[model samples]
Each structure stands twice: as C-alpha cells, then as structure tokens.
Target: MKLARDTWLIFQRQFLLLIRNPIWIFVGVFQPVMYLLLFAPLLKPALNAPTQAEAYRIFVPGLLVLLAIFGGLFQGFGLIAELRAGVIERSRVTPVSRLALLLGRSLRDVVSLIAQAIIITLLALAFGLTVFIGDLLLAYLMLALIALMTSAVSYGIALRVKSEDALAPLMNTIAQPVLLLSGILLPLTFAPSWLRHVADWNPFSWAVDGTRALFAGDLGNDRVWQGLTIVAVLTAAAVWWAAREFARSVR
Candidate 1:
C-alpha cells in the first residue's frame, strides 16, 4: 500500500514534468512516421505479400518495436541529467522509497512510448495498414513491457556510468547489435540460414516476430505467447535489479 501511494505521487511529479515538455513526443514520433510514409512504400514491391496492406503488416510491427527500442534505451539520459543537477542526490535525502523513484520514472517512459505508438499506429492506418483492435492493443502491451525492462536497465547503467560521454558510445554500441540481430526493419525469415540461426538467439527477435504475428492478425500464434512471457520475466528481473541499485545508491 505504501509503495503504491509513493509510486503514484512520484509518478504524478514525473508525468507533470513530461507534460510541460511535449517536444519529446514529437521527436520520437517523427522517425516512425517517416518509415510509414517513405520507407514502407519501398518495401511494398518486395514484400511478397498479396496486397499493400499485407506489406504494412510486416513493416509496421518493426517500426513499433524500433520506436520502443530507441525510446526506452535512451531513458537513462534523463536520470544522468538529474544526477548532475543533484536532483537524484537530493531525492536520496527524501522519504521517497528508492523503488518508487525507479517505478515512477519508468511509468512516465511507458506513457511516452504509448503515446508515440498511438501516433505511429494512426499514421500506419493512414498509409494502408490494417489492424485488429485487440491484437493491436496486445502489441502495445508488449511494447510497454519492453519499455519497462529497457528503462530499468537504462537507469541502472546511468547510475553506474554517470557520464553521458561514456554512456552514449556504450549504448550506441549495444543498440546496433541488438537492432541487427532483432531484424527490426526486415524479417529474418528470408535471411541466410546462418543469419537466421543467429537471430534465433536474440530474445528481441521473438518479440519482433510476435508483434509481427499480432500485426498480421494471428492472435493465437505461439510466438505471441513466447514474446509476452519473455518480456514479462525480463521486466520483473530488471525492476528488481534497478530497484536494488537505486536503494544501494541512496544508502
């Protein structure tokens, strides 16, 4: 009960800060919109799908996952800024629970991801993407879980590194490999056999595949369940690990 109350109050504070700066949403929304408008049409000829809408099924899911990755991965920048501003250091002296601090900020990240995702979805629809509402909602749920896990890990990294100069290169190095392995822009089904084998080991590929399935209206696909289960477990572990780190820092 106490945790929930503290988290809610902290979330309100974080959310208001986000509301006052709406440009972040626009920045996140732009790349996905570009892909939907410009890049997707290029893939339509090669999609092998029967219709333009079918091609969108393949492209839009990847754009959604890509948005989640870029949005969630850089979340630590805000924490680092707060640290330098002595905001986090000040919070350490407050009565707030350390876990609440992480959860509150992470909730703000999820909200941002959701709003960007909705804009992307609407724009995709305008570009001929067809979707089932329930499945689309499920895809967004997957994204939120992914964001939660990534945001927690980002916060942990920010606390450890504490320098944007070092952190930027480190995250970029990590993100490129994950994006390549996950096949975010294109499905790996047509990849070389060896490359497909490599993608199989990337847990994110499952999320991509699951979301692709959802986008195709295949709600009962096993990949969808596997993706959900993987992200849920990862989110729980990340939260625990991040909360522990934050608590140790406060101490």
Candidate 2:
C-alpha cells in the first residue's frame, strides 16, 4: 500500500512536470509525423512487397510503434536532468520506496508514449488506413508494452550515465541501430541476406512485427503472447539493472 501510494505521488509529480513542458510532447508527435509524411513516401519505391499498398500497410504500424519506443526511451533524459538537479538525491532521503520511485518514473514515460501512439493512430486513420476496434486495442496494448520496455531500458541508461550529454549520444546510438535492424522502416525481406539474419534476432523486430500484424488484422493471440513475453523479460532485466545501478549511486 505504501509503495503504491508513493509510486502514485511520484507519478503525479512527473506528470505535472511533463504538462508544464509541452515541447517534449510536440517533438514526440512531430518526429513521427515527419517519418510518416516524408520518409514513408520516399522509401515507398524501394519496398519490394507484392503490392505498394501492402508494403505501406505492413510498414506503417512498425514505424508508429517505433516512434512510441523512441519517445519513451529518449525521455529518460528528463529523469537524468532531474537527478542532476538534485531532485533524485532529495528523493533518496525521503521515505519513498526505491522501487516506487523507479516505477513512477517509468510509468510516466509509458503514459506519454502511449499518448503518442494514439495520436499517430489517429493520423493514420486520417490517411485512409482502416483499423478495427479490436485491432486498434491490441496495437495500443502492444505499444504500451513497448513503451514500458523502453522506459525500463532508458531508466537503466539514465541511472548509469547521469549526464544529459552522455544520454543523448547513447539514445541516438541505440535508436538508430534498433530502428535500422528492426525493419521498422523497411521489410527484412528487402535487406541483404546477412542483415536479414540480424533483423530476425532483434527484439525490436518482434515488436514491429507484432504491431504490423495488429494493424493488418492478422494478429493472433499466440503472437501477441510471445511478444509480451519477450517484452516482460526485457523489462525485468532492465529494471533489475537500473535498481542495482541506483543502489550503487545512493551508497
């Protein structure tokens, strides 16, 4: 009960901070819109899917979900900034449970990312993409999961680096490679044979594939379950690492 309450309090504070700073939200929406309008059309010709419409349908969800993950992951810079401002150090002296603090921070990013996903979904709908209620719900859930996983990873990175400059380069390094290898912008079938194997093993590939399936009305419960399983395991690993790093910092 105490942990949950503390977590909520922390979440509320973070939410207020986010609301006060609207630039982050604007950037989150703008980047994905750029990808959708500018990048998508530019790359349309290169996609070798059976049909151009099929290719568009396949890749749009992947890109949308990738935006969610990127938004959530990079938002850790806010946490790092807070830590540098002595907020985290002050919180450490409080009665709040460490887990609660961590969860609160992560959940804030998840919420923000989920909102970004919804905005993107609406934009897609306006562009003539049709999605069923059930499929849309599933896509939202998967995006939330992706956001949670990315938040955990970001928390780990923030705790370890503790510098905004360091976090920026790290975020770029992580996002670029993951986006390239995950087939979010291009289908794996179109990649070179060697790179195709790498895409197969990328965890982000599962997320992109799952989102693509949901949008295409082909998502199965089993595939959703598998993707969630991978996400859960990754989240656990990231949280554990972040917790350990946090503990080390406070000591």
Candidate 3:
C-alpha cells in the first residue's frame, strides 16, 4: 500500500511535467511517421508483399518495436540531466520508496511510447493495414513490456555513468547490435540460413515475429507467447536491477 501510494504520487508529479512540455510526444513520433510516409512504400516491392496494406501490416509492428527499443534505450539521457541538476539528489531526502521512484519514472516513459505507437497504428490504418482490436491491444501490451524493460535498464545505466558522453556511445553500441539482430525493417526469414540462426538468439527477434503474427491475426502463434514470456522475465529483471540502483543512489 505504501509503495503503491508513493508510486502514484511520483507518477502524478512526473506526468504533470510531461503535460507541460508535450512537444516531445510529437517529436518522438516524427521519425516513424516519416518512415511510414516515405520509406514504407518501397517495402511493397522489396518484400514482395501483395499490396500496400500487406506491406504495412508487416512493417508497422516492427516499427512499433523499433520505437520502443530506441525510445526506451535513449531515456537515460533524461536521468543524466536530472542527476546533474540535482533532481535525483533532492529526492534522496524524501520518504519515497526507492522502487516507487524507478517505477514512477519508467511508467511515464512507457505511457509516452504507447501514445506514439497508437499514432503510428492509426496512420498505418490509413495505409490499409488491418488488424483485430483484441490482437492490437495485446501487441500494445507487448510494446509496454519492452518499454518498461528498456527504461529500467536505461535508468540503471544513467545512474552508473552519470555522464552524457559515456551514456550516448554506450547506448548506441548496444542499440546497433540489438537493432540489427531484431530484424525490425524486414523479417529475418529473408536472411541467409546462418543469419537466421543468429537472430534466433535475439529475444527482440522473437518479439518482432510475434507482433507480425498478431497483426496477421494469429493469436495462438507460439512466437506470441514466447515473446511475451521472454519480455516479461526481462522486464522483471531490469526493474529489480534498476530499483537496486535507485536505492543505492538515493538512500
């Protein structure tokens, strides 16, 4: 009960700050929208998709995951800013639970990412992408899990490094490999046999495959459950690790 109340309070404060500076919401969506408009058209011929709609169905899911991955990984920059400004240091004197501190901030990032994802989905609709509402919600849940996992790790890293210069290069290093392995732009199925085996080791690849399956209206696909389960475990571990970092920093 105490943790929940503390989390809500912190969430409300952070959320109000977000409401005041909402431009970031659109800024984050812009790149994806550009891809949707300019780049997605090329996918139809490249992937041999039957129609523009089919191409979007393939593209949008991976795009959302891409959004989640990059968005979440980059969030540590904000933490570094706050640390320099003494925002986190000030919070150390408060009675808040350390875990709540991490949860509240991460929830904010997750909410923002989901809103951008919704915008992408709606735009994809205009391009003729079709999906069941139920499956769409499930896909959103998966994206949320990814966001939560990435956000926690970002915060943990930010607390450790406490330098924008170090954080930036480290995140880029991690992001490049993850992005390549995830196969967000096109399915790994098209990759050479050896490459497919490499992608099999990337959990995000399972997530991409699962999301594509959901968009295709395959609810019971093993990839869906596998992706969700893998992400859930990862989320739990990340939150635990981040919460520990928060405790050490603020205590």
The prediction achieving the highest lDDT against the true structure is: 3
User: How would you order the candidates by TM-score, starting with the best?
Assistant: 3, 1, 2
Q: Ten consecutive residues with minimal summed lDDT in candidate 2?
A: 43-52
TM-score of each: 0.98, 0.90, 0.99
Instruction: State which candidate has the highest TM-score.
Output: 3
Every candidate's lDDT: 0.90, 0.77, 0.95
lDDT (tens digit, per residue) of candidate 3 on 1-251: 99999999988988898889999999999999999999999999999989999999999999999999999999999989999999999988899999999999999999999999999999999889999999999999999999999999999999999999999999999999899999899888899999989989999999999999999999999999999999999999999999999999997
92: Cα error in model 1, Å: 2.2
Q: Candidate 2 on 108-179: residue-level lDDT in tens? A: 887887777778777766666677789879778777777777887787788888888888888889888888
Q: Is candidate 1 or candidate 2 better by lDDT?
A: 1
Q: How close to the true structure is residue 181 of candidate 1, measured as C-alpha lDDT? A: 91
Candidate 1 lDDT over 36-71, as tens digits, reads 888888786787777888888898898889889878
Model 3, position 86, has a per-residue lDDT of 94
How many clashes show up per model?
Answer: 0, 0, 0
Which of 2 and 3 is the better model by lDDT?
3
